[model samples]
Target: MKHQATPYFTFNGNAGEALDYYKQIFHGEVINLQTFGEADFETPEEMDQRVMHAQFKKDALFFMVSDSFTDQNVKTGSNIALVLECESTDEIQTYYDRLKNDGNVLMELQDTFWGATYAKVKDPYGITWDLNYTKEQ
Candidate 1:
């Protein structure tokens, strides 16, 4: 199974601005910018304009970013999460089982509107992980 770990940054409500700033600084382009309002699932009215997800790419360098949806604001030290792009369902399940053993399951593994199996977990070490496995279409 293939595994790619990418840095995912979370902003309180300024993810769009942050993405734009990064794009300018790194001379990258923001690809696939999807806002909460654009998602197939329902979102809070306040989150309608917030970024649900976006990718910044400059050649080989890439990262993901989104605005937080929780009641808590994004803290300085806890705004980053590691995203693991799994190649298969088995791969994601195995990782999820292992990671959640001594960790907190922030979001359980389940099919998403984006056509992928996704989950979020915070390990004992306090590092958050976002695991996603998209089926080939």
Candidate 2:
């Protein structure tokens, strides 16, 4: 029953600076930093040098940050978006299939290497969504 979307920002190779500045301005806590050079990135030459993801938290607020991949002509202003976490596989799969009708899917819905059901799609509205549903134990 969680409706909150985790906002993921995409910087143009300035994610570290952006996250740091925001942390200072909001007095936030910068948590994990996942760079693109890690094993998750296939084309590290294009993404390895960039920040894959970073977490910033303060008070009741929390968000993530990263850089837009240079391999694609990603829009600067509208590069990032909400990551929706569905409660169930059926819910997420159904939502993903429905959302991808006219949508550009970045990744097909499948079990990720991290052991989670994951998919990404950019809706016609130009908003990128990372839809994730953790496998129920």
Cα-based lDDT for every prediction: 0.93, 0.82
Q: Hey, what RMSD does candidate 1 come out at? A: 1.0
Off by over 4 Å in 1: 1-3
Report per-prediction Cα RMSD to one decimal.
Answer: 1.0, 2.1
Across residues 98-131, which tens digit of lDDT does each residue of candidate 2 receive? 8899899988999975568989999888888899
Give the number of the best model, judged by TM-score. Answer: 1
Q: What's the residue-level lDDT of 9 in candidate 1?
A: 94
Per-residue lDDT, model 1, residue 11, is 94
* Model 2: residues with Cα > 4 Å off, grouped in runs: none
Top lDDT prediction, candidate number: 1
